[model samples]
Target chain A: MKYYVCLMVVFLFSVQIQAQKVAVFDSYSDLEKAVLSDENTTYVVNFWATWCLPCVKELPYFEQLNSANKNLKVVLISLDFKNQYETKLLPFLKENNIKSEVVLLTDKDYNTWLSVVDKDWSGSIPATLVISKRKKKFVEKMFSDYEELNQYVNSIIN
Target chain B: MKKISVLLLFVAFIVTAAFTSIAPTPYKIGDVATDFKLKSVDGKMYSMSYYKKAKGFIVVFTCNHCPFAKKYEDRINDLAKNYKSQGYILLAINPNDPEVEPDDSYELMQQRAKEKGFVFPYLLDEGQKIYPQYGATKTPHVFLLDKNRVVKYIGAIDDNVDSAAEVKVKYLENAIAALENGKNPSPEMTKAIGCSIKSKK
Candidate 1:
């Protein structure tokens, strides 16, 4: 019985990534606190989920953006269900070697937050919100590739 | 850091905006949804015209692979099961192109309907033409129409995406009730996080 208990403990521990600091947001307004930065750094916030194929496809471009620039901040807001955070999300993150920050947003009331995120946003995954001190832009299209992603960021910064 | 002038930045921003912005849906509430013939899982072509006497239609732009759509599958089934006899038809359309998303292939859609015991017509939007016409942007998108083919309610099926048991706002059901009484559905349009419909940009 003790051996079985030890095995379960080990399994649970391995499920969570060691260094990734995942912030949990229950509401968009509450999330605004963390996203609303007054700093000089630009934040490339991508809302995604493990289930979205296009989201998963474009994720590497986001990673590229973060690694290429030291000053820019990349925040991945996962729309994955809270139940899948451990079983599916954590494992995927570890497998992909995700270096950017990941946030698990479990708020299911999308109608309330869609307008706030972007008045015209249709609440689609793989959506990006780029914010700097002077400007904030929301884009609904897929990044397509890393260059497109980088170019868009450059447009915002410059 | 070399700073670009604000005027130059604004021009670049405008160019980027063209690349970023998607074409907004031409549909608003009370718009008439066009009827189209699409092949269903049962190997039959179906259309809204066939259901001439249907009190309403819960035309869901859903697919086989979307996790959000999968989560709402049972709720959609329940909607068909309960409302079919009551003159409300659920036209479940797989709007995602199989070429772009192989998981939403016609064969898989048939398999999904069978396994899930779907009682409604699970149709395929062939040539990827139907969804754009209806302005459906994502899977599990609902466009409820009254008998006259006029769009009455558009958006999510419910408020909760995680679990059906915990759902507080039953948006589609309330809309159905409004239709029965010849009243406008409150909060006629809504939004929910869903997978973007796969197609050529």
Candidate 2:
């Protein structure tokens, strides 16, 4: 009887966890409303994926940036597959203890949204864009340290 | 009976493995290439069919963000200039999601193309539907096609990702040369290095 109850409890818990919400953006308008609404709040949008080694390597800097900058809004968008949200993405986020607001991109076509973010983008990961009311800065290279990321962000904010 | 069942299960596993390993890539050597009508840096339309009469085409999937791709930018330009008159054309495609990677946008692509003096057409694959069709897995992925539009070679430009001196194999050049001479390429495909081609969600 005890074993049966334990088994039932385990199944219930699994169902609850599986039902947890996974972020998916339908359009740029959806993303803008969620994370980019406040013009006064400087936004740092980091594009990354689980399979990308450089992206994984630089994730800590994003975390550090989010924690250190109270005035800035850091959004870490995972480019992993929507189906793998539970299997791959959620575990990664939990393991890293990522504190930034996490969202998953849901656009099926790259061209449609490539220009939506910036006309200069070339569909690369580890790419970052810093947006303020007055100015916007985009960097397509990976950063080795928080200092490099901070320098770029500071340049824009100032 | 038990032993027979075990044997059957092992056979099934082996068959499955073989099937998985032998799956054909989307693009292969000698296949008629599809023309892409994509936007170029100058806001003009560029298509592979425009150069259908060329000796060969070097289609590269590259992006602005990857250090590996950046390292080979000058080399690619050199290749374009050296071979353009010889009926060789270079076509670069950027297939990343703009929302996720705003720097890969068409405007930035134009700026980078002009800034780098790209002799080839830097086209934008806005929807990223074209890359997977070519089985491009990474930035700086090279696909060499002969005049008949057969993919003669697919992979990296060279063996080294960091130092050019350390490059033991010039895969792209070698393949192009072999095709020109009507000879089969020695090392047709090699492992490509650089950023994974960004896929649309």
Q: Against the true structure, whose DockQ is highest? A: 1
The sequence of per-residue lDDT tens digits that candidate 2 reaches over residues B31-56 is 66676888888888898778757888
What DockQ score does model 2 reach against the true complex? 0.06
Chain A superposition TM-score per model:
0.85, 0.83
Q: Lowest summed-lDDT stretch of 10 residues in model 2 chain A?
A: A106-115
Candidate 1 lDDT by residue in tens digits, B1-201: 236577788889999998887665657898999888999999999999999789988899999888899999999999999999999999999998898889999999999999999999999999977888788889889999988889999999999988889899999999999989989999999999888999866
> How does model 1 score by TM-score?
0.87
Model 2 chain B weakest lDDT span, ten residues long: B192-201
Q: Write the per-residue lDDT of candidate 2 for residues A1-158, one digit (tens) a residue.
A: 99999889866765564455657885656877877778788899988888676799998998899878888988887776566777999898767666677888755344446556677564556788888884678877688899988888888888
Report the Cα lDDT for residue A17, model 2.
Answer: 45
Name the candidate that leads on TM-score: 1
